[model samples]
Target: MATFSTRYSRLRDNVEEEPNSSAFDEIIMKQEQIIRDQDEDLELVGRSVNTLKHMSTKIGDELNEQAVMLDDLGNEMDTVDSKLNNVMKKIAKLTHMDDGKCTCSQT
Candidate 1:
């Protein structure tokens, strides 16, 4: 009876002192879940960054087109100014001629 009691006590101690592997597995699963959430957030941020870059490029293109149109308008305005100056000069000459200061010798 004493031998049996000692043997049972030793076996109980060995089984009771075993490491809890389920605790480690639970910790590992929690860490994996956190990593998956972080990955999803990173993907969403990457997509938002790409969208902003595309919009910026589109705005730049539109500004460039507007700049070209402004240049064309400036050139047309210069041509109109030259034509107006020529017309003014002709009108001044005609007005002076009508003022009886005509330089024609066959009057």
Candidate 2:
């Protein structure tokens, strides 16, 4: 009868230890899942950053192109201004007489 009691007590202790071990395993599984989720989030963020960088680089390239075009336009405007000044000087010379008087004399 004493041997039977000892076996029963050992079985009870074994059953109690099983729940504790199971709880530890559950905690480890949850921790591993959390780590995996965090790794995925970080990868997504890295991809987003790369996309933003590409867009910003494209924008910068477009801005440079626009700046070059603006400089070309400015040079063209200067040429036009020079031509206009020449035309004005010619008109002024035609209107002026050698005596610095008006060509349409008063009767």
lDDT for 83 (candidate 2):
100
lDDT of each: 0.89, 0.89
CA RMSD per model (angstroms): 12.8, 11.9
Off by over 4 Å in 1: 1-19, 98-107
Cα lDDT tens digits, model 1, 17-39, are: 77689978999999999999999
lDDT of 2 by residue, 16-105 (tens): 456587789999999999999999999999999999999999999999999999999999999999999999998788789688876654
Q: Model 2: residues >4 Å from true position, as ranges?
A: 1-19, 100-107
Q: Give the lDDT of residue 13 in candidate 2.
A: 52
Q: Count the backbone clashes (under 3 Å) in each candidate.
A: 0, 0
